[model samples]
Target: MGLVIIFLLVALLAIFGLVRSIKDKNLLGAFFAFGSLAVFGWFAIMTIIYNGFPVAH
Candidate 1:
């Protein structure tokens, strides 16, 4: 639902941050970004799998 969408957006931003951090050689930023990506991405995927797209009210 709405939560899944928010998680996906955050995960997408994390991907961008990961790329930027790698390009800038910022290890700490990259680490945090990667962690964010993993957590948010996992949540988004699991939510979709468990609840189905568009979800049921």
Candidate 2:
């Protein structure tokens, strides 16, 4: 439960970072933001696929 909530919040932040970088037109910032987003996104996808949401004890 907590992990899911935290993961969602982090995901939101990553998206926000990406958007802000784009708005500022900073290529380096955008690249790093996207890289960070990709890392988290991969973990999210893996968790969803293997453990599933709401995670079992």
Candidate 3:
């Protein structure tokens, strides 16, 4: 529950960052936004794998 909420918040922030980056036409900002989003996705995947896929088990 808490994880879901946190992820949701991060997602919103990431989207905001992405939009800002796009509007500013900043390559660095866009890179950061993508990197942050990738890290979040990595964490989520790791959590699922560690917890047994939440489906296989």
The order by descending lDDT is 1, 2, 3
Off by over 4 Å in 2: 55-57
Q: Which TM-score value belongs to model 1?
A: 0.93
Q: List the residue pairs that clash in candidate 2.
A: none
Residue range 1-57, candidate 2, lDDT tens digits: 566557667777888999999999998988988887787777777777786678457
TM-scores of the models, in the order given: 0.93, 0.75, 0.59
Who wins the TM-score comparison? 1
Comparison by lDDT, 1 against 2, better one: 1
lDDT of 2 at 1: 50
lDDT of 1 by residue, 3-52 (tens): 89999999999999999999999999999999999999999999999888
Q: What's model 2's lDDT at 36?
A: 78
What is the number of backbone collisions in each predicted candidate, taken in the order shown? 0, 0, 0
Candidate with the larger TM-score of 2 and 3? 2
**Relative to the unseen true structure, what is the C-alpha lDDT of residue 8 in candidate 3, on a scale of 0 to 100?**
49
- For candidate 3, the per-residue lDDT at 57 reads 29
